[model samples]
Target: MIISIIHLLSSCQDFLDEKPSTDLVVPDNLEDIQALLDNEYIMNRNSDMGEVASDDYFISKQEWESWNEITRNAHVWADIISPTGRFVSWNALYEQVFYANVALEQLDDIVPDSNEQVDWDRLRGSALFYRSSAFYNLLRIFTMPYHLVNPELGIPLKLSADVNKLVKRSSIEDSYAQVIGDLEAALDLLPSRATIATRPSKQAVYGLLARVYLSMGDYQKVLDYTSLALELGNELMDYANLEQGNTFGFKRLNEEMVYCSYFSSGSIGYSSDTFILSEIYESYAAGDLRKSLFFTQAYQDGHVKFRGTYMGNLYLFDGIATDELLLNRAEAAVRLGNEEQALEDLNYLLEHRFEAGKFEPIAGISGEVLLERILEERRKELVFRGLRWEDLRRFSGSQYEKTVTRDLDGEIYTLEPGSPKYAYPIPMDELQLNDMKQNPR
Candidate 1:
C-alpha cells in the first residue's frame, strides 16, 4: 500500500512537470512575467489607434470630405465607422489598458533576488506608461475638451484587468487626473534609457506629461515638462543626410526621440497612405527639404497620388519626438505672453529645418501675426506626424478660420471650425452598454 502511494505521488509530480496549455500559462515567475511586456509592446505597434488619431485621418467622414478626395473615402468614411473600421480607436486603446493593468498587477509578485526583478520594474513602468498613453488618446477622442471642467461627461476609465466587470464613464476631470497619476508613477520607475525602442523611459514619461498638460491648457506644466523632455531627447534628424533610399533615420533616444516603437513592413500602410493632407502639399515652399523627404508626387493618366513618407517608417522607428516639445513650449509661451521665448523655440525648429544659418529671425512680429506664423510653421514641420486635427480641435476656442477641403466621389466639401459635427459621436456600443451621455452633433 505504501509503495503504491509513493508511485501515485511520483505520477502527480510528472504531470505537474509537463508543459501547461497556452491559455494556462499566466506568467508564474519573473521570466514569465517579463513576457507580458513584450506582448504589450507588440500590441502597441499593431494598434490602429495611432493612425486613426493622426492628422491624415479624420474623426468623421464629413470632416474628411472637407479635407480632400482620396482622404475622404479612405479615412473619413471607410476607416471610422465601417465594419472594417469598427471603432478600432476605442477598442484597440482599451485593449492596451487591459493588458497594462494585468502586467502591473503581476509585477508585485516578482522578488528582488529573482534575476528578472529589475526587468520586472522596467516592464511595470512601461505598462503604466502605455496605460496612460492609451487613456490620453481615448480622452482626446471620446471626451470633450479638458477645459470644460465637467466631470459628469468624461470617458469610461478602465483601471483593472477584469474584462467581465462593467465600467461606467468617469468625468473628464477624473480621467485626466488618472492619466496624470499613471504617468507620474511611470516616470518614477522607468529607466533613463532601454535596449528596446518599445519600452518607455523617464524622458518618455516627461514627454507624455507635456502633451497631456498642453491638452489640458496648463501652459506652465507644459513648459516644465517640455523642457525636461528636450533636455533628455536627442537632436533632430538632419535633412542634409537624407538621400533617396538611403538610411537617414532618426536615432532612438537621441535628441529627437524620447521613446520609440518599431513597425516593419506589415505596419506601414495606415499612416503612409491616409494621413497627409492635400493642403499641406499645396502649402510646402519650394526648395524645402521637407517637401522632398516627407512626400512624393506621382502622376498617372492625369491623376496624382501624393504619397507621404514619414521619416519614422523608413528608419524602423516611430515615437513622440522632441520637436513636439519645442512646438508645445512655443505655443505655451505665446499663450502666456512670453513672445520672445515663443519666437526662440519657433526659430530653433526653423533653424534646424532650414539648415544652419539659413533661418533668419522675424523682426518685431507680434499679436495674431506671430501666432499665425507659428501655426503655419507647425503645419509645415509637423505634417504627416499625426497632429493637425488635434491642434485644430484644442485651439478651437481661438476662432481660427482655417478651412479644410476634401473631395468625395468627385464632390468637394468644405469644413470650418464651429461646425455642429466638430466632435465625434460616442460609439453605439458605449451608448448601449453604459449610461454615458453622447456629444451633441
Candidate 2:
C-alpha cells in the first residue's frame, strides 16, 4: 500500500494513510535513498544559525557598535561552555548528524540489484563526512587544545541514530580518535568526484583529513592528505579570469573549494557589506589583484563604504578548495622544518595574487618566519570563511593576538581574548532541559 508522510517539526507520528517519521523513512529503493540524501544536502545548505552567530565573518560595524553587546552576551564565541551559545551550536550540529545517522542506518535495506553498489557507498560516505564535519566543529569550539596530549575536558561524542539516550562527554583524545575514524572510513567509501558540488567526494574526505590532522598537530599527516587532495587538479582560481557579477567572483570558494555552503542575501538576513581591517589591507603590496578583486570601495560623506563585500558566501555553495590545501601544506612544511618548501608554497599563492613578476621570495627567512608568513597569508586569504575563529582557538598560544578595535561615538573599544565575555553562556532553556555542566564564567 502507498503511504504518505507528514513531516512535522518536533515529533514523529503516523496517520492511517501516512507513514511514520514524516521527515525520514526507510527507503524502499535506491531512488528513495537518493531523495533522502538530497534532504541531507538541504540541511547543510540552510544550517546557518551557527555561522550567523560566529565571528568568522561580519561583526558589529561602527554603525552598530551596540550590537556587539548582544553578540558578546548571546553569540560571542569563546569557550564551548556557554549554555545559550553552546546549546545553539551543539543542537544544530547534532541535528545534522541525526539526519546523517538516519540515512546511514537505512543503507543496508536497499536492494543491491536496484542500486549501484558504488552509489550506496557514496551516500554512506557523504553521510559519514557530514557527521565527522559536525563533530570536528564541536571539538574545535568546545574542547581545549587538541594537542594537549591527554585532555581532561572534551565534548561529548555522539555516534548512533538513537537520540533518546543521554550521551556523556568524551575526552579530547577520544573525540579526535572518533573524528579521525569517521573521516578515514568516509574516504574509503566516497567517490573521487561527483557530477554535482553538493555531494562529498573522495577528495573532499582527504581535504577534511588534512584539516583534522593539522588540528591534531600532525604536520606529516597534514602534508600527506593535502598532497593527495591537490593531485585531484583542484587548482586555485586565477583572479585574472574573474569578471563582475560572476557568481564565483569572490576568492573564498570556487573550483578550488573541496566543500562549501551556499549563501544568498535573503538567506543570510544581514548586509553583505564587508570591511577589511586597514592594517590587513595595507599589508598587500601594489599590483596585488586580491585587494581589488576581493573588495570594493565606496565613499559616502567622507566615510568609507565597503558594502556588498562578500565574505565567503556560505549559502551559495560551500566546498573544499585547493587554497586551503595550499595553506595547509605551507604550514605543514614550516612545522616539518622545510623552510624552503614552505616559502615555495607561500610564494606560489602570492604569485597568483599579485601581477606577474611582482612576486619575490624573501631571503634569510628561517622556518619560524616562514611559518608566520604562511599564517599571515592564511589570515588574508581565509577571512570570513569560518576558519578565523578556529584559527584563533588553534593558535591561541601563538604570537597572534585575538583583538579587534572599534571606534564608536567618540569612544574607542578594544576586545581581547580572556575577557570576562570571551565565550558565550549556555542558553537558559538548555540548562532547564539537561543537568549539563555550564562553562565557568
Candidate 3:
C-alpha cells in the first residue's frame, strides 16, 4: 500500500507504513515492473472495510469488542477518531495506485524487441487494470452513490509517479470517467483472457466496465459491456460436478473466474461467519446446488458456516467471474423489457446452479414481477462476493427499496435505504496530510 511515499523496493522496508523512510528504486525494465505488479500482498490486497460495513455478515458481542476502535466504530456506522486507521482503507488502495503509477510512467521507457512485445503489453495492461480496480474499490466506501455524489467529495485521483505531488480530489464524474478510460485502455492492450486469473484480461476489463456502468446507473451500457465480456469468457462453475466433501470446493483460477483477488479485514473473512444471514440461507430451495456447495454446518455449535468462496480456500473474494456478468446482463435485459432475453439469461444461470433433474425454468413471468424474481436470485447467488452492500444501496429509494438493520447485543444499528450514512468517512489523517475534503458523516 503506498503510504507517505511510494517506494520501488530494493529489499524489505515496508514503504506502505504511514511513516517510513526508504530508498525509492525506479523499476526501469518490463521484468522489474512486472515483478512489482506481481507482488500480491502490496499490489493486490484491498481494504476489507466495504465487507465490514456491508450486511452480508455479523460479528458476535465478544468479537465486536475485540475489534479495534476504528473497526468497531465503522461496524456501527459511527465516525472514527482517525480516518487513516486500518478500517478506513485509504492508504492501502493508494499503495496499489502508486505501484500502477510507477509502472505506467516507467514501463514505456523499456523498448522490447518483437518477441517481448506481447509480454510488454500484458505487463502495462495489468498495471492499468490494477490501478482502475483500486480506484473503484476506494469509491465504494468513501463516497455516496453516483446519483448523490458531489463534485467536491470525490476521492483523491492520483495519476502520476511523482511522490511529492499535492493531493487533490477530482469530481466524482471525473473519477469514474478516469476509471473507464483506464479500463478501456487495458482492454485494448490485453489478450482476450489471461492464462491465469491473477492477471487482468480483456474479459476482466469488460466485466469491470459492466459493474462500473451499473453502479453509475447505466443499464444499457452494462449490457453493452456484458455482451463483449461474455463473448470472451462465460464459463460458469457447475456445483453438481464439485466434490461433495471437500472443505473448500472451488479452486483459484477456476473456469468461471475471469479475475481473482483477495482482501482480509482482520479475522472476519470467508470462513469466519458462524451464522449465514437467515434470509440468504433460506432463499435456497432444497435442490439448489448453492445450498450444499456454498455452505456447511459449523463445528462448534452447528450454526451454518460459509465454506465455499469462489476465490478458493481462506480468502474473502472480490473478483470478476462469468456468473456475475450473467446477472448484470439479465437485469439489464429485464430493464430493457426484453423478456425473452432476460429469462434466457436467468434460466441459463439457474439451470447450472441446481440439481440436474430438479432444475426448473422460470416461465410466463413478465414485467416488474419477472424483474423482482431475477433480482432476488441475484441477491441469493452473489452473496459474500462483496456485492450485497452495493446491491442494497442501488435498490434503495427505488421500487425494490430494502432497509438493512444489524442487531448487535441489545442495540439496533440500521442503515436505511439511500441514507447519507451509507457513505463512510475518509480517514482524517488523509484529510489533514493531503488537505483532502472529508465525506459528510
Candidate 2 matches the true fold with a TM-score of 0.80
Residue 151 of model 1 has an lDDT of: 63
Per-residue lDDT tens digits of candidate 3, residues 192-285?
9888788888999999999999888899999899999998867887778878788766877789888887775545553344367767877899
The regions of model 1 sitting more than 4 angstroms off are: 1-24, 40-42, 46-86, 114-117, 148-150, 245-255, 261-278, 298-318, 355-357, 361-363, 401-405, 410-422, 430-435
Clashing pairs in 3: 1-95, 2-95, 83-427, 83-428
lDDT value, residue 31 of candidate 1: 62
Candidate number with the higher TM-score (1 or 2): 2
* Model 3 collision count: 4
RMSD of each: 9.3, 5.6, 3.6
Of the two candidates 2 and 3, the one with more favorable TM-score, higher being better, is: 3
Q: Tally clashes: model 2.
A: 29
**Candidate 1 residue 14 C-alpha distance from true site, Å:** 28
Model 1 agreement with the true structure over 99-160: per-residue lDDT tens digits: 67777777766566667556667778888898888888777666556654346867778887
Q: lDDT at 418 for candidate 2?
A: 38
**Which lDDT values do the candidates have, in the order given?**
0.62, 0.61, 0.79
Tens-place lDDT digits, model 2, residues 326-400: 899989988898777777777777777777677676557876777787888887776545565556545545566
lDDT at 377, model 1: 78
